[model samples]
Target: MAIELKPTEALKLWHDVNLDLVRDGETDLTTRQMTILLTIYLDPPPHTVRGLAKKLAVTKPVITRALDTMGKAGLVTRRRDEADRRNVIIQRTVQGSLYLDRLSDLIIARAHALRP
Candidate 1:
């Protein structure tokens, strides 16, 4: 079944999900980091810093900085591609998958509880 919510309800769901993340005592990614994380997981692989920067319309340095933070959190790993050493490939982690799973649950729960 399709889900539907008013604009206020949608924002409320987002707020609640984000608030839960903040209180979860885990790695709370910044908005940029979250966007990058989602894009990486939602899209197909062979993710490169150059590709992400271009996709997000940002600079290579900006993507690098975000990756650095996420990398420290063990959410992602990067390595120089063997085929093309110039490209830094971004790989997913178990922790990152679990994090998004928890986030998905929170969003679903909040959406279900939205006021009619």
Candidate 2:
């Protein structure tokens, strides 16, 4: 017997689930920022702003802004691409890696708690 839920109900459920983490300060990242950060962190070092924009399906400006914010937050470092001096490459800092590790741990713990 499958159950159907209204769109609002589903959204509420998702909001509640997400809000719990925010309320507890488990994650400070906005959805878009987190997506961009994880996308770059998951891959090899030296991710370009353009490449990150493409990967995240967002505009280059969006990626640029996110990178700037992340940079200010000490979560990432941007360097001029050696091969292409005109382009910039983004890399995760030690702090960034630690943040990612913490996020993964929190998510895994939450998932485990939900299991029987």
Candidate 3:
């Protein structure tokens, strides 16, 4: 069933999840890194550095730096596009999917503990 949350409840849940993540010692992602990660996972495919920069209203270098960090974390990968050797395509990984799934579960558990 879907649970409707007021703004305060939503904010509290967000805070609780962040705290839990910190306690778990998961790699702390910056706001920009999180944005880029979510954009790659949640958005449609054929994701390119240029496309992501345009989508996030940031520069190519900004995306590249974030990707470098996330790549080391095994959250995302980049490869030259076969169709266009000059273009780099961003790809998702099993580790990245599992990481997001765990975070979702953490948020859900925190939300369930909230009083109506």
Worst 10 residues of 3 by lDDT: 107-116
User: What's the C-alpha lDDT at position 104 in model 1?
Assistant: 87
**Which residue pairs overlap in candidate 1's backbone?**
none
TM-score of each prediction:
0.90, 0.78, 0.89
Q: For candidate 3, what is the lDDT?
A: 0.91
Clash list (residue pairs), candidate 2: none
Query: What lDDT score is found at residue 31 in candidate 3?
Result: 87
Tens digit of lDDT per residue, candidate 2, span 2-113?
A: 7566686666656655766688674677788988889878887668888888887889999888888888889989899788898998887899999888767765565444
Clashes of each: 0, 0, 0
What are the Cα lDDT values of the candidates?
A: 0.88, 0.78, 0.91
User: Which residues of candidate 1, in runs, are more than 4 Å off?
Assistant: none
Which candidate would rank higher by TM-score, 1 or 3? 1
Better of 1 and 2 by TM-score: 1
Which ten-residue region of model 1 has the weakest summed lDDT?
A: 107-116
Superposed model 2: Cα runs more than 4 Å off: 1-17
- What TM-score number comes out for model 3? 0.89
